[model samples]
Target chain A: MKNKGDIFVISAPSGTGKTTLVRLLLSRFPTLSFSISYTTRLPRPGEVNGQHYFFVSEKEFKKSIAKGEMLEWAKVYGHYYGTPLTFVQEKIAAGKDIVLDIDIQGAQAVKKKMPEAILIFLIPPSWNELQRRIISRSSDSPEEIKKRLEAAKKEILAAREFDYIVINDVLEDALKELVSIIQATKARANKRWPEIKRLLQA
Target chain B: MKNKGDIFVISAPSGTGKTTLVRLLLSRFPTLSFSISYTTRLPRPGEVNGQHYFFVSEKEFKKSIAKGEMLEWAKVYGHYYGTPLTFVQEKIAAGKDIVLDIDIQGAQAVKKKMPEAILIFLIPPSWNELQRRIISRSSDSPEEIKKRLEAAKKEILAAREFDYIVINDVLEDALKELVSIIQATKARANKRWPEIKRLLQA
Candidate 1:
């Protein structure tokens, strides 16, 4: 019998370079799978439907939520976004580790639903670095930047709830830490029980 | 404030290549420290007094035990062995991660006293491999080999008490897993709280 795979719920405030890290992580670990969220928000430039997100109508997104098909859902900035329960369950049952990139609230909801899910928070090295990243990556007005910074602080406080934290000081170092967390989780006793049992019996 | 370090307690059955893996792990992670146990047994070939173990008389070992200086101790093969409590506490409080190579009972004892200590178990990939390694590495008689195999089986069963398991299938792969476990533990939320808090305040 195969051991069930792990569910890694990774959350980070905007401008923490989480997206880039996740992209690199997925590429490095071929067996790792990403869970794409279903969103009612319009796709941004270069974002593909079903690849980046399953772009859905507001009614369709609401329908999934009402039908209990969504594992975790939240309305952020007036856009509905959620993870589908079946996809995550199927992948994990098939012994494929899945990465879920979501906001803090979504991560909390997922953790509540699936207590085994490993929660990871990504943060910038410092507040100044966080602000620099936000400003450099966006064309937001000073007021907008201020608002995002405030939100980031609140999210950073919630980081205490996470099981692991990756400091995005340097891309390479952050990626290496992230990879170590994934590889280490795979070595957990519960995850390797089947193979271990087989060896003992043999 | 400096971030408090971790105590990684690694346990394995005989012939699992644990000693080789641990030697390589310590070489790679210079910041990591090893906790040498005090033993009543005489030093084997190539074993240094303080480096390999603190060779002590049985009376001295029992005195330490009476004084509550031993962190964890066990009698095996008519020899007394134990960790020095003050050394582990001082190194950890000074922000140095320490690795403890101990038996299953000692690992369980350390965990009881220090709940935060991460316990890792190393095992051979297969029972046949475990037997082969034991036979090849020693000049033990067939009866001694049989006794060791029985002991190994019991130790393997105790692996469930561990937090992580590294299968010693390929030396390189096992070393990589061992390193990943150490790196990942350093990234744990509790371990990085000081740095994370400083960033938030800044």
Candidate 2:
């Protein structure tokens, strides 16, 4: 049997402070390893191949799917995106905690496979604030922004299904809370059996 | 609508350092609280009502059951043992996180009622070690110890159903990990919505 690693899936509306919170979490806990998705989409300006995504060709992406290699895959913005199960498993085996910034659908899929993964949904304070944040992203036009806002409402509702709901109200405080949770979950006796045995022997 | 506090059910066979972990967690984090179980057993010397087990009459305990005041209840050694639903609900309402150190059956019952509650199973390093610890407690006879160990094996197997498993290998290290998990779970954007809202407004 494989020892499972805890997966924290942080989901939110595009501009509900998820990226910032993730960045803060990464910097605060260098031990945290972020999961990079594999995408068939072209890289945006200044985006590195592995850092932003594992930019793969359609042929390779298809081959991966044929090999049943991905943990979860979805079509987004006319491109294919997926999480490589092997990459995550390897990082976890190396004793590093990994975070998955994914959509609710992807999160659910991951959990269905690994039920121990923690699903954390980030919500905007309110519909109005979510609306404002979406408009500010500047990656979309007026019509596109409206579509995103509409999608966000459904996504926020999806938050109800998540394991925990944290509002991105404050940056530092939210990040601190996350750090505490990761540490706390590991303290569990079942997860710490080997360590506990070692400690008791010590 | 109630913004419920997270319910953490912590269970372990005797002498796996569960009490030490909980005590350390409570002392270190003021936000953490313990759920005090209520029992219909007569109070021993120096035991106070409500503070220790909420001492009550069998009639009163049965009345509580009729009123649905208990979250989970069991008759043990001619005594009724249970958790007061009202006490735990009140603490949640007041925004205090509560930890329940209960039996496996109680944990399952509570989880069914509050599906959001996180379940953790604590274990000793090994079955041999668990036996040694129980024997060392000086509170049970060899026969009683055998019964407990036998029961523990059943409980440990059932732990596979729990959300997380923590080994009580080293008290301090195990406590630290438990602290970390609780921290991360609470920090989850889903759970921290209120704080996130307040922070953005500030």
Candidate 3:
């Protein structure tokens, strides 16, 4: 039998450049799968139905939660968001490593449901750097920027709970660390058991 | 305070090309320290006193073992070989990572004495390939080759107990995997706790 794949859950505070890092990681590892979340919110102009998210009506989303189909669900700004259990299970069973980019709360929820999931937390170099990144986004008002900085502080404290931490000091360096973590996981004894057995018998 | 460095214990069966991979790894990572072993056996031609092996008399070796200064020691072919504990401790305390290349029995002993030591086992790709490599060494007689192959089989079985297993198939690929394991260990939560604390306070 093929060895089961690993599930990596990545979480970071706002303005930490988590999205950019995750995008680069996925692009580099073609075989690695990305876990798409189910959302009740309407898709943006560029978002695809299945590729971006499994967009569903509020009624359908609630039905899935009641049926226990959602692996982890949360309501934010009156819109429901969650991971579907079946997709992750099927991919992992087929030996496909999957990456999930979510918030700290979502990461905790995923860990509770799937204890095998590896949780990684990303952070900026310093509080000042985080504030600079947030304020530089002209789209946010001063009040929104202030609120984001406050949230970033609380999220930074949760870094202690993560299995691994990647400091986003230089984009290239952070990417290297992230890649190393993924590659190292594949060398775990449990994951390489099948090959070990074959060699022994041969 | 600086984070205490990690102890990496690498074990491999005979003819696995472990020596080449380890030498390359040390050259690539200049900051990593190699744990020099003490041996009662006389040094081979051109071997340096301190750089190759700490050549000492049986009296000195036994005294160190009695004082519990030896981390792990074994008597092979009527000669004593062992690792010194104080050197390892001092290097780690000074925030320097150390690598120990030894046999499976030595690796197990180090793990028992230092529970945090990471044990990595290296193996050849296949049984046939292993035999080919061993026979290619013209120095060994047929009887000696047969004995060595038996020992290799026993060591291969011990790979299951290791924390990581690296297959020495292609030299370059194996080196990359070994390097990734070292880099990933540095990102463990406990190692990065100090940085996380500074970020939280900031």
Candidate 4:
């Protein structure tokens, strides 16, 4: 019974309700934990240490990057954010399934290091809804939002590389699909064949 | 919103509860349909014409093989058993999820033809339990039991090629896993990406 914590790498374009879905998953699946990212960006209002991010200085962040401690990192909105490999590995060792709330680049980096990780791309049901949501939830200006949407084209293309693509049409349906994927991934032959063989021997 | 029938190819050694699990799946998910296999074998005591198998003459079976109408076919216990391609294709076209109860060889054949099919292999929790179930059921004599056990060895070895290997340790657990697998397979990125992209374009 090898019950190792498996990482779920979630990638989504802006305005796909990725954050809300992540929170919903946290509430729905008790076994899941979030992988807090390390960033050089200053915390926004109401953001707390270790809750939102592990804020670090430019020099410290760069040092971590140089040491290859980051599973995936990128400079966005003139700030750096990345998943720390050490923290994720530690949580997995503690038998907690961790969600990597990352962009495509970060997801790819994690996949390269851990081939067993499940990569899921969250998709907005329609472009009109996506644009509407992005505008409505503007933590960014119109100009900034345009830039993010432009970047999204490139990000959405990466969905083709993911192991699963979840349509964020309805929150409940998407969440149900996500949990089912976790359960089903665990039942994969590569994961369970050994146990079955051992049972035969016993 | 395209609802393509997701396909699950399930294989198991004899007496591993595959039949029971599949029965539960059919009743549990109204959207699913089990592929009816065409066979040349004379029906066993209680088997029906289209339920246990779609009985056909040896000539008809060979003709189907020549016409490439069988998805997969093999000789078993001196008779031919095969899945009819048209039956599976029709159900899928009609948007009914399809489950093919097959051996590993049949699963491999189907997978080669349909690259997207999800393969699930079922196993008993232990050899002792499997043996007990088979012997206690008293379906065969001691000599026949030995042969079936030997065949089980060869069949279980082939489980490695499957996508998921579920242990029927408890029927409830195995059935839950099977249901989860069918749901999750539809979420595979390769299967969903194009549709997601199209929805976004709309």
Best by TM-score: 1
Report the CA-based lDDT of candidate 2 relative to the real structure: 0.79
Worst window of 10 by summed lDDT in candidate 1 chain A: A189-198
lDDT of each: 0.93, 0.79, 0.91, 0.87
What does DockQ give for each predicted structure? 0.83, 0.28, 0.76, 0.78
The top-ranked prediction according to DockQ is 1
C-alpha root-mean-square deviation, each candidate: 1.3, 5.2, 1.5, 2.3
lDDT of 2 by residue, B1-202 (tens): 4456778898876677887778777889787778888898889999888767788899999999999999999988899999999989999988778999898888889989988788888878766778788888858788988888778766776676677777677787667667667766666556655554453454
Off by over 4 Å in 1: none
Where does model 4 exceed 4 Å of error?
A1-3, A93-95, A139-142, B1-4, B44-46
What's the candidate order when arranged by decreasing lDDT?
Answer: 1, 3, 4, 2
Question: What is candidate 4's lDDT per residue for A113-176, written digit by digit as tens?
Answer: 8998999999888777878888888889889989877777678888999999998998999999
Best by lDDT: 1
State the lDDT of candidate 2 residue by residue for A135-177, as single tens digits. 8766778898888877876676666667777766677776766
Q: Write the per-residue lDDT of candidate 3 for residues A1-202, one digit (tens) a residue.
A: 7889899999998888999999999998888999999999999999999998999999999999999998888999899999999999999999999999888999999889888888899989988888888888648888988888888898888878888998999998999998899888999877786888898798
User: Model 1, B1-202: lDDT tens per residue?
Assistant: 8888899999999898888889999999899999999999999999999999999999999999999999999998799999999999999999999999999999999999999999999999899999999999989999999999999998899888799999999999999998899999988988787888888777
DockQ of 2: 0.28
DockQ of model 3, rounded to 2 decimals: 0.76
Instruction: Rank the models by TM-score, top first.
Output: 1, 3, 4, 2
What are the per-residue Cα lDDT tens digits for candidate 1 across A131-182? 9999998898999999999999988988888899999989999999989999
Candidate 2 chain B weakest ten by summed lDDT: B193-202
Please give the TM-score that candidate 3 achieves against the real structure: 0.96
Write the number of the candidate with greater lDDT, choosing between 2 and 3: 3
Better of 1 and 3 by lDDT: 1
